[model samples]
Target: MSNVEIRPVTPADHSVWLQLWQAYLHFYDTELPAETSALAWQRFLDPTEPTHATLAWRGNQAIGLGQWIFHRSNWTVSHNCYLQDLFVQPDVRCGGVGRQLIEHVLTQARNAGSTNVHWLTQATNHTAMRLYDQMAKRSGFVQYRHAL
Candidate 1:
């Protein structure tokens, strides 16, 4: 973890981003369309796009990914950013890669005029929940999702 570095994701990072993204999918036991990944990668690099992400690098390897977006907030006094996806390779979990990625995102959000950053994770994701719970105050809110 000594050489781990977290930086904004760019279009030039397609291949390495793919590796970490695929590992994230494997962790959730889910399958995603390749086109969707490509689209996301492109959108992240588009400065006009609302959603952007950062990739964590450990030496020459991409180790983690985080996708976040900003929008007007009714709860907060000002706009805020929502972290949509955050994942790190299981082999290197809890080694500070994820933390660094999150911190970097926070910096980005602040630079974007966002007053707060928020995100959600599966309740069963104990390893991630541990880190998340310690980062910010956990509101007792429940989420409901409906698949189209």
Candidate 2:
């Protein structure tokens, strides 16, 4: 962990980013259009885009990614950060990579004066939920969605 640096995602990281990005969607049983992924990569590079990405590195290699965005929350009357995607290489679990990414994002949200950082995961993803439960209180709001 000492060697790992969590920094902004760069344009050169596109190729590796796509593989991890796609894996994250697959793990959730979701399909993301390649074009959309491309747009997200581009958005990360664009200073004007609200999108911000952080990549975890152990020296020169990228092993994980966290994509986050900020928006005003009417309920909180302040901005909030949404950690839209977080994934670490399957081989690297329990090495504190995910925890570090989460902590880093939470810090970012706080530094931005955000009321909170939030995200939703599949209810069946117990491993992830367990970790989240430890970090924050469960909001207990049932989630529903319909794909058009």
Clashing pairs in model 1, backbone N/Cα/C closer than 3 A: none
Cα RMSD, model 1: 1.4
Any runs in candidate 1 off by more than 4 Å, and if so which?
none
Give me the overall lDDT of model 1.
0.87
Tens digits of per-residue lDDT, candidate 1, 1-148, equal 6698888887679888888888888878998899998888888999998998888888878889999988887777778999998998888999998888888889989988899899988889999888998888887999998999
After superposing all C-alphas onto the true structure, candidate 2 shows an RMSD in angstroms of 1.3
Q: By TM-score, how accurate is candidate 2?
A: 0.92
| Distance from true location, Cα of 46 in model 2, Å | 1.6
Give the alpha-carbon lDDT of every model: 0.87, 0.86
Distance (Å) between predicted and true CA of 44, model 2? Answer: 1.2
